[model samples]
Target chain A: MNAISSFTASLPGACAQGLIWGIMALGVFLTFRVLNTSDLTVDGSIATGGAACIMLIRSGVPAWTAALAAACCGMLAGLVTGLLHTRCRIPAILSGILTQLALYSVNLRIMGSKANQPVSVDKYSLMLSQRYVRAAGLSNPIPLLVMIISALIGLAYYFFGTEIGCAVRATGNNRVMARAQGIDTDRATILGLIVANGLVAFSGALLSQYQGFADVNMGRGAIVIGLAAVIIGEVVFGKLLALNFALRMSSVVFGAIVYYIVLQLVLALGLNTNDLKLISAVIVAAFLTLPNMKGGDRDA
Target chain B: MLEMIDVCKTFNPGTVNEKVALDRLSLRLEEGDFVTVIGGNGAGKSTCLNAVAGSFAVDSGKILLGGVDITHMPAHVRAKYLGRVFQDPMMGTAPDMWIEENLALAARRGKKRGLKWSISERERAEYRELLAPLGLGLENRLQTKVGLLSGGQRQALTLVMATLKKPQLLLLDEHTAALDPKTAAVVLELSDRVVQEHSLTTMMVTHNMRDALAHGNRLIMMDEGRVKLDVRGEEKKKLTVRDLLEVFEI
Candidate 1:
């Protein structure tokens, strides 16, 4: 197969990963974009989800169910940040850091005496009963993409349309307006964190299942990756927060696809593995400055 | 039907920046009473509305709506009885959602929200009916994102959304103060139509002395956190912008 066809064939995988990581993008989106609060909780919540899913899946729960439970675990992790921020009057960013630090140990305990689990090597053997893979045919990426994308779009569209969604959006855009409209800003912040982290952990659950294990180190650079995808998504649409639901979701999904394609290109070109971090950093810097890269003057 | 008894508020309490926003500030509103308030910066106009809406717990006060003591209720709990439009158009609704979605959220005020579908055909029809009243051609734009609307359109929509649930009190905190003169006039007309149609008790704060006298049934002027002028009935109808300025010596 030519490089082009090969590249086209792998596009769906990247979209699916983008779609999954969009959950992380969403958590990042809420704290950063929507609530206008800087929350670093996602760095730890991603690992929390992976650890919970790995531990649960090891004890004989279905992978799908394990993923859902992991999402809940991630939500509780966010709840900690919310409580700290609201009850203690701490700044939102600092509260996030406190929770992120505490969850480091909490996540360690969820992994069953291990710091992390590797799924590519550890999960292939135990993913599902033999009958399931045979039934699913293990040959098509379309089904997985179909399921994940549907969940992301449908749930996202619905959640942001509700009364609570309005409250959350209002809180982020202007706390004073929310208060005038009778919305409890504290409650809105807490709700945003719960939903954001829940989606992040959902991505983690899928990440472990698809790649075949969870690792403690997996979440170390997650905030940067998630922010990159979100920023890339925003760049595609010009980062207008008030864009309609479709554009809002597209920012994150498109971002993830572009991020993956870049990595795939690097892998295909035989780039040194040790240079991955440097490559990621450069790409992030470039994307960060992409709007500025346009010939338009910054002041203009 | 709203009452504030000796409402008192202090900001940055117990610190060097301690400032009294409201001090022994008492106010009352009978059913369908519309009052306009004007004050200089830091004159406590916004703080009064905040205290009544439960945005902050007043240090010492009792707030009652239709004779129910709601002084201690959280903001959301009191929201059912209060409809509000803010100075900024973007402050009122979720801009990312569709116009109808914003309307749906407002239309169901005081009801429990569930995981069920939010915008059904019936809900859309209801939203269309609500938008039809505005006559800004917004009923046709239910699918549009509210963020794409003009400032006047947003404030008009906000007025419609505020009254959709028929709250006991409608509060406008310089809602049109942020708009241009022409757009502000359109929004003010919409506000007048909706408030009169619902017979809603209302309080509006505006810097423009003319707007303070034009639409509402009564008018109030605040100076240094106190009511400097209050007029209603024939006295209010006979008053002009000059009368208001002379009364407050502005």
Candidate 2:
């Protein structure tokens, strides 16, 4: 009875976290699956988002406005990485790494060199918070998070159907073909990076608000978690759902939800919280390798 | 419609692998000219085509297209006036996209891409009519991914895409070399029909000596980055395989 109640009590919190992290996972899906680039900038940019949002809110800015600023901060980080890759001729992975390394200091500066900053819910009207996870009233965080995720998905689905969006997809699908068609692949790449990092930062901003504080190390191993969500969503829901872009994206969110609920269960079962990163790494590696180990290596 | 003057290209300068790919080469094409290019390996045949297509900056030269000096234009920007089909079937189309989506992409080549929906009802109807002549049944498979298409089918689709926008110049870099003999013949035929119907200025590179002679009004043989033989009109009509072999032996 005790174990069951504890699990039930923790389920809502885990769901909230999953939904929030699902936004970051959507960003990962954009760069990883859509743009076909393994961007590592999210790790540092998420922290930048958190730092920017909390700092802005602490300075008396509105929460929503602060979230937008955080997303812009993330977009700038992606732009730096994009320019480094395109204009400076650096490889994609290395450019992301360099930008992530540089963002460490930038995030620190944003937080006034402090390792952490707290946004008091009593003093500020945050959009979503842990306090509202089980609240009986309209302040429940799940509905709002779901609404936000749906809105983002709708926007993405619409955008990707547009001319510029098709060009971006073509750029990722085949650079040579894109160039042949007069699509500026460099511009497409930069735009994809900007949009991806913007989502990641936006998630970070929401996460900081949810947790009531932003820590410098909060975004550590974030890419792994995001990937785990993506892979988990794809592997689990892919067979059950119709193969549409929007459904695939929504699966990524569900993947995050499932991931957190499982994490909560593991912790309840006596797994050390500190070893969660190792477990995440192992999970991602296994999931990443499973498809390749099967029959995907054979070419037609 | 196309001119290459004093074009020069050297690969890996200052290295042991340094090779002069194009050495002060020059060529001129009249409007509506369809020229077939032939060469042995290392003859800079593809390099010459790539230079005109702006794949890379020429070491030194001027390339004029339809009275526009495009010597320094970036490859994508230059694509506004040019259509290109590569030897590799995979190089010409986005594999993950649908057939109609790929056509839609090519339809907007060199044109501004905005927030408008990529494919419309009118464009879909146009694509169906355009693809109906190809006889590949692609009109009904508009939503089919290009990756699922055969190499020959892909090349045919690429041909349609290249000419969809009526480019100022069309470049075929051994476009049919990778296809089977039958498929190559069909693509080559389609190439001729499209080029003639559109009155397009075209440059086709071929490894098959007979194909070089068989198609196009003018034929040029490239050797050591220079034009060893250029024949057209009566001189080109009377030429045979023996004469091309003699030139190759030299």
Candidate 3:
């Protein structure tokens, strides 16, 4: 009964975390799989979203409203990085570093008094099902219920089908060709960053509210988690190379679910919380090597 | 309606390995010009196209297209006025994208307000009509991934894509050079059909002297990054392989 109860307790938050991280997982999919470049702004921007949302909600903004604001802020951060890379001609990895560095100060400002927000849940985050429960005057597991109801999946489907989304996906595959076809690779990069970081920020917004507090370190190790979920998704569900946009998206979502399950196992194995980053690093490192190993060698 | 004024480009400008890809090269293309360019390897034929395509910012020069100064433009900005097909068939179209999706992207040239993306009924009708001219039965494969197409088919499709918007200039960077001989001939014929049908001002660069002579209303021979011999009108219409060889001193 204790084991079953403990597992149940962890379910909502873990699942919510997976859904939230699913946003970043899809974002990382753009840089890693789609854009065919690496952008690390996700690490800081995820936190940037949390900090921005926490501060906003504390100022009396609605929960999902704060989340939307955070997503916008995340998009701006990503825009800076995309501009640095595309306009300034800086390499993609270096551009991400520059944006990540600049965001550090911005995130601190968002935390306001140097401490993260601890706004009353008032019924969990606005996105959590508790808000719906409050409206309905009934008992409900807000997180699980809200996850199914949110625009997360539907919005993803819609965005990936747009003309701009087609152009963005093509940019990941080959920027030069996309541009030659007048797809405007620079614009695509900027938009991809905006969408990517927006998703991450949305995740952060939901995460902060669900946990009942927003911490400065909540975004730590987020990239590892996103990548693990993405790679695990590619592994277990097979690759999405030939699949349509919707299937590819659902694949990444599944990847995020499996990744958290694996993460939970690590906790069950008696690993310390501090060692989690190390474990994540090891997992990412292992997955990164899989592509190289499978392909034999393909340079240029 | 295209011109290059004293265009110059030097890679590794200050280094010993520096190469003057274009040196004071000048050329003019009248409206409806279909200039066939031919030269040996490292003769700066591709560089000339690159300069016009905005693939590289020339060290010193002015490229004007349709009376607009585009020399300062980068590749993507100049793409509006220019349609390009690369030597690598894979470089011309997005492989993972469907045929219609790729066509939709091409169709976006010179237009705006792209509301997210909804391929309207009119757009679908337009795409089908556009593919019908290719005659490869590709109109039936609108949803098929471009990656699965043959090199010849892709190249033929690229020809359709480059001319889709009827840009100010079309750059065929040895587009069919990557295909096998039979496939190359088929693509070349398709290129002729599309260019003629659209009446597009086109530039085709090739190493085949026969192809150069066999196609286009105008012919240019480049040497050491400069247009050494340009023949057009009646003279170009009467060009022979031997005459081109004499011009190249081959």
Using TM-score as the measure, the top candidate is 2
Task: Provide fnat values for all models in the order shown.
Answer: 0.31, 0.90, 0.65
Error of 1 at A86 (Å): 3.4
Residue runs of model 3 more than 4 Å from their true location after superposition: A1-9, A113-116, A122-150, A239-242, A286-300, B116-118, B133-135
lDDT of 3: 0.79
Over B1-250, each residue of candidate 2 has an lDDT whose tens digit, in order, gives 8999999999999999998999999999998989999999999999999998888899998999999999999999999999999999999999999999999999999999999999999999999999999999999999999999999999999999999999999999999999999999999999999999999999999999899888999999999998989998778878888899999999
Candidate 3 similarity to native, TM-score: 0.90
lDDT of 2: 0.94
Q: A67-160, model 1: which lDDT tens digit per residue?
A: 8899999999889899999989999989988988888888878886687675443444433221232234553444564466567777777776
Q: What's every prediction's RMSD, in angstroms?
A: 4.3, 1.3, 3.2
| lDDT of model 3 at position A249 | 66
lDDT of 1 by residue, B61-132 (tens): 789999999999988778888899988898887776578867776765667655566668987887888788
Docking class of 3: medium
The residue pairs that clash in candidate 2, if any, are: none
